[model samples]
Every structure is written in C-alpha cells, then in structure tokens.
Target: MTQKNTEDPSSQKNDSDCGCGGETGCRIEAVLSVDERGQMVLPKDVREKAGIRTGDKLALISWEKNGSICCLALMKADNLSCMVKDILGPLLNEQDRS
Candidate 1:
C-alpha cells in the first residue's frame, strides 16, 4: 500500500521564487511509479505546464547527501547547458589569469 504524505502545504517554503532564500523548498507536483521497463511518465498536466513536448530533451540531475542519493531534478538540456556556461564562464576566465 502507498503511504500518503501528511505534511501541511502552507508550512512548506516555495522554491519557485529563487530570491526567497529557500534553496531546498519545493512543492510536490505528482507521485509516480516506475514501470517494469524502468520508465516513468510525467503527468500530463505537469508536462503541459512545463512546456515539455514529445521530442524535448531533459537532463536528469541527482543530488547526493552524505554519499547517498537524496533528490533528483530535471531540466531541459538547452537550459542546463546555458546554466552551466553561465556558472563556469567567469570561473574559467579567472583561472586563465593565474
């Protein structure tokens, strides 16, 4: 049997607002189960809301705490690449001066 989460939604912080100082806060969008083929489907409404389409590529990112996996995140490949470049570009330039 599946157990339901009993946490209060209002007590949770919202991560959608990045400047809110809550980096780990997020709302549960949906609960999904993996199939025998190791595939899970994103809910229709969630997909639509996120503008995900059939041919879209996603980058799966896993977060580890204490050497164990704690969380998973997904972003479009294009966005992920842009984020990586934005974060690394300045650091790379600084290293070049050394």
Candidate 2:
C-alpha cells in the first residue's frame, strides 16, 4: 500500500485540461529565510527529491531577467581533460623519451 501525502484542498489550484504549466507541475509556495552567514538551507525533502547529498557539489547560477533575480542549482560539469590525462599519462611519458 502506498502512503498518500495530505494537502490542503483550499490551496489546490484548478488544473487546466491541457496540463502545460510550471516545472513542478503544482502550485505551492514555500518561503525560507536566509541566515546572516550568506547561507540558505535547502529543505530535506526537496534535496532528497533532487538527489542532492553531502559532499555532492552543486552549481549556483544567477541571472537578471525582467528586473528580477533568478537562481538555479545544477550538477557540476566533469573535467574531461583530467580523465584523459589519467588514461594517457603513461603513453605520453613514453613518447616524450623518443
């Protein structure tokens, strides 16, 4: 049996039959306060849903569009050069001797 999360009916918005809407697909607002140390804590449930964990790096992107600031979090891009060096380090060293 699956457990259902209870939501307030009063807060529910009428969904359009076309179903094209926000990225979350639901209209819910959550307000959070930032600390004095320039840190904002992500809610546990939101973090878990996004597959974020301790020691996992995240990139913060900020943009100014339409007179408002927008921020987003994304996974860090891998350094392909580092991986290539690790794989071809021995072969490159041998070539330098010739």
* Tens digits of lDDT, candidate 2, 1-98: 99887997645666432233365465433556789997888788877876777886666545454556544434433434566688899899999999
Superposed model 2: Cα runs more than 4 Å off: 1-29, 66-98
Residues 1-98, candidate 1: write the lDDT tens digits: 99999999866766443332334576678999999999999999999988899999999988665676667878889899999999999999999999
Instruction: Using TM-score, give the best candidate's number.
Output: 1
Clashing residue pairs in all predictions, respectively, total: 0, 0
lDDT of each: 0.82, 0.61
> Could you tell me the TM-score of candidate 1?
0.66
